[model samples]
Target: VESISVKKIETVEEFKDLKIQKSEKGRGISLTLPPDIAICEECLKDLRYKNKKKYYMYPFVACAVCGPRYTTVNALPYDRERSTMIEFPLCNEDKTSCVKEYKDFNNRRFHAQTFACAVCGPQYQLYDRSKNIIETNSIKEILEITARRINSGEIAAVKGMGGVHLICLAEDDKVLEELRNRKKERKYKPFAIMTPKLAILENLVIFSEKERELLTSFRRPIVILGKKKGSNDGILSNQVAPGLSSIGVMLPYAGIHYLLFDFIGQKSLIYTSGNVSNLPMGIRNEMIFEQLKGLADFFLLHNRTIFQRCDDSVLRVHNDKVKLIRRSRGYVPEYLPLPFEVEISGALATGPELNVTGAVLRRNRVFPTQHIGHIKSLETFNFLKNALFNIKNLLQIEDKEIEFIACDLHPSFYTTTYAKELAEKYGINYFPIQHHFAHVLGLM
Candidate 1:
């Protein structure tokens, strides 16, 4: 017998499906961030069950409640029109079914914009370094091939919601060594690992209930969990965390990620940004092909165009609240209201070189763009410009705002240079505060 529990409470919101509406800057409804979600149980069921036509053997299958959002979204209101999914229209049969389910208020897929099935969803393929199609149009076959290659200690550049990730069997030293050598990764920095389930995570790390919730939270940030006593022997490679007492772990967030864990039958894979050090991670197929051709043995390429390249969000629980270490992908371009209204209006701050996030103050509220990566390369500088432009539009701050641009006073820092350029373009004043002074004032 199937029954549903219903609760009604008096509120200002009469919600249907996840209705994302385009709101003006500083006044738009900040919905639950698209980042704080993981694979739901029903989708999991669809993956492992016998329903071959619906979700079985499909990698990109997603319902209304899950799958790619911030990465695929090109504009606000978060509709398919504003996303990279505009290219792949649903087939006629799938479109009919989608419309029926969309109009049905009780269905889980009601108005699910990212909804797709085996018959009409995005497809996956496996390719060699030369772009030779190793496997085509078969997620199961791709999984099988990826599993074999990973088990044999080869690196796979697997695509996901936001961007491509470099994955290898976590326990393989030879593979880790190869990855380190190829990427020129430092010896001490640990690579994050993706496990299949919480049970395996429990075995590997000493965690609290909050940490457990965080581990399994929809945001699915990489939680830095302390190592359980005697847990690292043979189960993990020493290279994963050279001298660290904690391990960064996450579970599968997408269907393809879950399928990979199922087929590999391994608990952990060394998951890292699929880019060279000091550069942005790759998102487009051509970008990956060009940037990671020599390093990756097999490429799990997909046709989906990632509208923006967002690295997986990274953070750790501390003192009961999660502290952000690297906020991208899952947590970019979110607006926050000041506890009390600020006296200032229309101010902009270009943050420091490392852990870069720019902020604009509009109508006494602060809206920070998601991490723009290190402001070093020419490409990154352009990204910073785009971020500033996008956030300005989101916050509805006109370019003519007479306020000044604030940035670090570091003589040779690229951010400072960018600030000067912005000042010149906008005919605004440039405020260059000392980096150390900013740090001290920030703490105060």
Candidate 2:
């Protein structure tokens, strides 16, 4: 559906691999689900290479093949205006160079949706808990300052494409304990650690080819890796994962994370959601500071508005088969084909409470929203609605077809109530499918 044309060749020997018919043909509008791809080598080189012009210290630098997608996007055609990046317009050099490269098929940035440079893209600003600006002049210096704070055991809230993360040097046991206490997270819940690359983990954990692939893939989910046999694990504080032999580890998926790695050196960082326990991940910097109170010593944030809050996806390979733990980021806003084709078109399915998820059936595909936290609170419920529409608008399924609204049979549930209201308003049939029946059919 995405590709334009096909050509027949006389023979394999006659085929020239790199031939292009350059003409005055129209460029197609790019339609992408835009998962948060791991920053490509080119962008990483630009961050490290001083001669890369405006791309140096540009935390959000990206090309068409990589960078943020679902987190920054609002609605699509996948245009920049539909993304959080719409707020940052291109600078003169970046705009002119982008146009020149975009017109040339040979350029890597040709038709790149998220292409950006330092002068024309979002810049990271470090602020205190009161939101006072600490550093804004240069990313190199900003990261250096943030690194020093972390080394001194000060917690910093680093904002990413998805949401804000409360981060600190993971080597300090006191810092890990403080972060866990501040977040009020479960004692049994392990904190995921973020690092620069995969090479650092070679001595830390046992890695299979599949595990390495998942760790380095564009989705960039935290893969739970088992500890190496009889290997000492005193370097990273035990408070990170407590008694668990395995630890959740991830590589830098966004440009900002990679830049932070440069200054932070080889040390691990406690990267947990920037919100108190039982609440959604904080998006806006002001709201994050309010929620975190004085826990975050410095706020490393940018101007990008997260369309929807997405937690880092977590996966574990059990018996060499991938087991999804927390499904968000990288894997969302994409469709899952049902076992049997869903007959109804544009049907809404309101999932059950806790570990909650929602979906919309458009054509033969079911577009499930990313894990929308528990709908127990008003805030989480609002997040559910926002995520539902975010996926709907992106899928271009605005007019809800008058098919049945599927909800759990339980009465008085928030999700069920919302489904009833939507069904009534749309004059559609509502099915109160039993939660057990749903369990049998795997609908839940």
Candidate 3:
């Protein structure tokens, strides 16, 4: 039996004689899980090395340093089993099979939960809008086809990190008009343009020193930039930014996207969510076929499954400060140390306002899922529920161990209502936190 320690204390009044004793023992090693980091310089060097076994041209060659984080994750405790990696089992050829052990090894793949080789990782496939398979081997071919189609004035539905994107030639007025007409999107909101890189963006838009720095930051968020004076106003349709003085822009973040830019050689391309107006981006093949059949001419798709649907996070530098407009993708999983230590367990926090979700203290680490869009419709609501349940089970948490349930104070929020249902079903204490207060605590 373990021995317990007791300490006596002194106080005033009726409780002066009262004594409190606490037991001290080695609980275990505390684990601190951080949000997935960007691809470190070391890993990038390895990827560029030609002679290395895992070198350049390998699209899936990611290590613990950088890769998918919230997008690929199914649940908390962010283990491989709870991630999209589960779909692609580890290659037996590699001695380090498991993600945990792989991270422990002194290799490039160390700490990379989403790390995998082309042999045992997510793969891509291209298809026409009619669901006919076009190509499968090389993603470059699909990009080539899409680029040609775009140059010829056609909208292409390009699948990306979290969701599908409706891509069209930014410089082609007829193409933009056609897309607008097809979608019937009112010229109220601005569309985000995907540029090859910062270098290309500098040519198109005037970037201040601060703006340049934020645009190239690891988060690589979409930065809204004012149009350059004397620039070709005809390059983009005026409808792209109806009332806004600036345009939203982002650089390519993924290898496939980089390849597309390389093939196109164009400075920028119009990129928007690949879905009908007011609907969430299509996730599944069936959903894509049903929802986006008439909207897109071709579909550049892949076989890898997306556990959660995340939209691109938008940010702007205002009053010399970086303000997050749409928090998703790169800026999620905001890491904050817990105020008090409780049981070594994980919790899934369904964020308030629109549809934001994050996981907390999985192995003492918290990773917020990228911004899931507004959970208004049944389809989006169902996607949110699935994402939550999948993340919970992925962290290997049993139904009973969930001690506390958290939700927003907003009564009309679907997430809040669902959280209440979960609490009732599990007989757990539910804490209704105010949305603004939660945001304040997050900032702290």
Clashes of each: 6, 0, 8
Tell me which residue pairs clash in candidate 1.
Answer: 36-218, 36-219, 37-218, 37-219, 38-218, 333-370
The residue-by-residue lDDT of candidate 2 on 253-337, one tens digit each, is 8778877877878877878878775678788877888887656877888887777788889899988898888888888866766
Q: Which stretches of candidate 2 lie above 4 Å from their native place?
A: 1-5, 9-31, 94-96, 229-232, 400-402
lDDT of 3 by residue, 1-444 (tens): 124799987867574342223223222222222343344555556555666544354455566657667667755555677687888877666554444336454555545567776556766667787899985465456567766777777788877667788887777767777777778764456788988777767766777788887777666678888877533466666666666668898876666666676677765788888877556788776787788888888887767777667677788888878887877766654543566665656555665647566454554556445556677687767766666665555445667667767889998888788778888888877788998898798787
Predicted structure 1: lDDT: 0.76
Model 1 — which ten-residue stretch has the worst lDDT?
24-33
lDDT of each: 0.76, 0.78, 0.67
Score candidate 2 by TM-score against the native. 0.90
lDDT (10s digit) by residue, model 1, range 1-444:
124788987899777665535544343323333542466888788888864566786777777887777667655655666677777665557444655665566778766666677766788888899988884456677788889888999999988877789999888889988888888755568999999888987778888899888777777878888888766787888889888999888888888888888889956899888887666777788888888987798899788888767777788888988888877755665666766765565878888888788878776567677677887787777667777776675445567864888999986888888788889999989899998998897556
For this target, which candidate reaches the highest lDDT against the unseen true structure? 2
Predicted structure 3: lDDT: 0.67
Cα-based lDDT at residue 56, candidate 1: 88
Clash pairs, model 3 backbone: 33-365, 64-111, 64-112, 74-391, 75-391, 103-111, 333-368, 358-368
- Each model's TM-score, in the order given? 0.89, 0.90, 0.75
